[model samples]
Target: MTDTPGWASPGTAPSNEEREPGASGPTEPADRPGHTPPAPQPGAQPPGPGVKWSKEQPPPGQWSAPTGAPSPQQTPPPPPPGPGWTGQPPGGYGGGYGGPPAGYGGYGAPGGPGAWGGGWGGPPPAAKPGVIPLRPLGVGEILDGAVSTMRTHWRTVLGISLTVALLTEISLVLLQGFVLNDALAQVRVGNRAANPDEVFRALPDMMIGAGIIAVVTTIAVVIATALLTTITSRAVLGRTVSLGEAWRDARPQLPRLFGLILLLGLIVFGVMAGGALPGILVMAVGGDVVAGAGLLVLGLLAASVVTTWLVIRFCLSTPALMLERQSVVKALSRSAKLVRGSWWRTFGIMLLTGLIVRIVQVLIAIPFAVIGAAVSGDGITDLLGTGGGHTGWAYLIIQGIGALIGSALTLPISAGVTVLLYIDQRIRREALDLELARAAGVQASGAGAPGPVPGS
Candidate 1:
């Protein structure tokens, strides 16, 4: 019972006079540019010459009686469909009820179906549940977040790093005092003897023992770094994870993380090696001259510059490798890529983090050092069993404590930033906010039913 307008009705076509308001209508077919007038339908009424009609005319079902306008009860053409209309065929627009647009069967609509059925462009993706919105973190915010994470999870972060560091330091202490010192003592004693060849004989044994210790320390450092990275990341995100969980997550990344660390170490060593050469040459030349000093300084400066460049280039790769589950080389390459256009910003963040951590370390160490010094009769000598001098066990113990304290305070911050940087990069590169929302137990759009965070 609905009215459909005719193609030739006045409502559809403009009147002839109105079409050519101030000019004559086209007389020749060629005169009209691209427009073609519709041909008359078979048996349809043709316009009489010189006849004209006004613009106003009611649509179908709206005819007026002999001499007046139509009744007001006639409905105007339904206003052009609003913006929400998808322009589907009849019965496709909200099941003909004219409520919301078609296909909207979700909650709160009239009783067409269950509340949650059919996609209604469901609630604008709920703020990723449980994930603290990653507000653009400034240096201060980063520092504060790190501090807070450490304060909250110090037991785990500090405990793990402390245990590892302690084991490392103990091993180092023992190797240096017992193994290396005994070997040196043997060499010294041999030198005192008549046989000069004994020194050479002792050297190989010393070298082998040193090599074993070095390999062990290297392995320990690799393991420790992986653990630290995992712990730091979890802490920074304010997520609780067990030590075993962290270790397991970190284990796979050990090789690449260690490689990155080794790469950094080599860069620093290379710089120092390069710098040492000129200094050594100057010393060999016995130069008190200004040019010799200048050459030595220049070499040192060049080495420092190279070292700084290397540091900045690879600064974020370790965490990137760990968190991204990338190969060492790939992580390094990706990190270099990320840093290509933002080296200075990366450097500044690193420098700021380093400066703050170092200051804290110094503050923590100073009191211990002072206490150790004050307690010993002759400046912490008796404390170490080296009578009345600073060369004894006491100094070692105090230094060890200082190192431990510093590590405890600074380790989390350094680890946290590195991991956060990896996350930040991922967020920037990928729309990782969606992933994070899912991780935080939020129902991300485009994902199916709201579910608990995976792996939780």
Candidate 2:
């Protein structure tokens, strides 16, 4: 007779540690038909493909060892219903020699048992004692983590994002309020000039100013994305960090992260270019107009598909690069593996998040835009150039304030959800809960990460 570990289930024979002093393990019950087996221990490897996790048969010969010892040749029957396994509806009492009830299969297993019997080997994962419960997360939980992080570590999360947003917005406002205003004035004057050539000639400076704005804003976003990603990774483990600490951790990866974004951008551009090239060449060389258009559409469709795949494929790479400290290429490969079975789920969540963020931006911007127009109260003159291409300074400031607030809120949610999603994927695939618990200084124990408790 072998000694059972404390975490072993009812069907498994109990060791000395689990029983009362001088008590033997519970006896096996007589034959039963439909009893399900107990779940695997927290550390058990998931079953191999096509192999359902079931209680081991009592070695074909000996059954449970009775406290009173059975005589030599005769075998004891299966264990009796006891405290933890009293013929319970689903307490996972083991059945006779055969495995789990007929046709039992785990979730994702082929011909899996009915919904209630998802055939999961164990109880649903217990809650890991951390910022995020260590397990694959539902959509609501991922979103909750983002909000919870911000609420819990406002000093760090909001501080970093706020500083970034404020400085960027200030520079942007000044650039548009002063320099771009001058550039636009020339364009307005050129518009009224008798010679239309003047309008074309005056456009370059305005274009240059717009380009500068785009470049500066992009740099701000890239830096913020890196810093926020670092903060979220720690926050998920319930650790509070400072701005300096966050920056120190994130700074090393910023250069590579920036390059990764640029590389992704290039890939997307290449896809679009490749898709449209056929049509562009046909039109340039005087080929059939209809055929060129058709090819262009077809090429663009192909490009869109490829571009989206790349985007989803690498979606988890940023967090991988930061949290795992993996190189960019390795992170990308890691993300690809985690995402292999859940492409559509990831894609749908991402699309929904994008749509939601966009809607929020528009909602916030629209009211501010209306307020700006109302305050400025002179669009007609500006349009007619009676005001020298001027909309009131107040108008610009108000609009910028709205944009600033919108960005501050949106940036954290976007970055946090992305990182949490990455962590969730890893928990499901690589058993990241074990790593996260260790990081958070929580001991891994019999309990696994459980579903969110209502109202908790």
Candidate 3:
């Protein structure tokens, strides 16, 4: 048996201590199907002279002892029977062969015959010192662990998420208010023929503005992911952390993390570009324009498939890098290794998490968008469909506040799921729960639930 319940390492054989009695032990005569013909009755008769008993089948008087009972060496011979003794064994019922010993209760009683019939209960539950139990986790448990981390460490989680969200929202607000406002206003919603030149002129500025916003948002997400990953790891150990502590722990990984994100972005860009390169070449050569368009669409579809596979394969890279202090390349390799056999499962969990986060954002954003449009004298339809003609400071500020709230609530959950998924994968593949158990000071039997580590 393992020291801790359900923490057995892969490939180890179960010990005899974990097996039922007599399962592999030597068998006795009484345990065989047929009876050994009752011990030759006391001196009633003997075989005639020259008659021989077979050696293969021992005589009745020499029958072997019964299984699961005291050996002959342990107990003295029974006393001779008295008048009307009815041939009962010395002790009472169950003193002799197959019957259970007296005082062992009958069918329904504890330690009775029914107990030996094998309904061993399910394996003992794994130790749970913190948000997740120390074993391979289910999808629900993973989600619950993420939420529990956020709820349990709301202070640090909220602080980090809100700070990043506000900074990102502020940058967006400024860019839209100052730079994108005029650029976007130049393009007429209708009459494309008349406003062709205006559209062409505004396209460059609009692209630049959008690119800047993406960069700023990426940076904010990186910081939030790093800090939240650290906090989530600590939370799994039943320990609390502060924003300052989390920042200090995650700061060193930030530069490498940024590099990793950039590397992935470039990879995706290369894939998409490569996918469309052939079609573009066909179009550039001025041959088969329709065919080229068709090829381009097909190429883009293939590229989307490849891109999705790669993203899920490397989704755990962030947590691996942050927690293992691994290089960007090593972290990528680690994620691929962990996700090797479970790609679909990982994809499903991540997709579910994304859907939930998007839902939350929409639920929170629609109200603010509606109110902002109402206050700015723009219709809600315009706000939802087109950006509307006006996005005044009041509208931007209100929208920013709503975004901040949504992000603060959702960022930790996203980061937590990533971190916890990494953990769950390791637990399944590497038997990591044993190490976690030790770190958390869980007892061998998993009954001595210790408090969180003192310095954690």
Output the number of the lDDT-best candidate.
3
Sort by TM-score, top down from the best: 3, 2, 1
Q: In candidate 1, what are the lDDT values of residues 1-456, reduced to their tens digit? A: 123321112233234443444433222233345967778799986543333433443443333331233246643324324422333434233343224655554223644454334343432333423222342334565556566666776777777768876776677656665566545555542134424345444544565576556555444544554576766555534478777888788777776677776776666766756774775576457664445446656776888788778767876777677777888778778788867766786788778888987898788877776676676445743333334212335545675688676766676677666655655555555656567665566545533233332211
lDDT, each prediction: 0.57, 0.67, 0.71
TM-score of 2: 0.60
Q: Is candidate 1 or candidate 3 better by TM-score?
A: 3
Question: For residue 62, what is the lDDT in candidate 2?
Answer: 38
Best by TM-score: 3
State every prediction's TM-score relative to the real structure.
0.56, 0.60, 0.68
Candidate 1 backbone collisions, by pair: 107-115, 381-389, 383-394, 384-392, 384-393, 384-394
lDDT for residue 45 in candidate 2, whole number 0-100:
66
Off by over 4 Å in 2: 1-76, 80-125, 166-222, 279-301, 377-397, 445-456
Which tens-of-lDDT digit does each residue in 1-456 have in candidate 2?
224322233445554444445322243322335756567789996444233323443333234433334455544444433322223233232332323543433212333433334424434454556456666677878878877877877888878878888998899888888888766766664345435344433444554686577656655655666687777777767667889998889888877787776776677667867887887687569787667766866887898899899889888877777777888778788889988989998997777767876788778877886777677766545434445565678878888888888778776777777888887787777788787778778765533444453321
Better of 1 and 2 by lDDT: 2
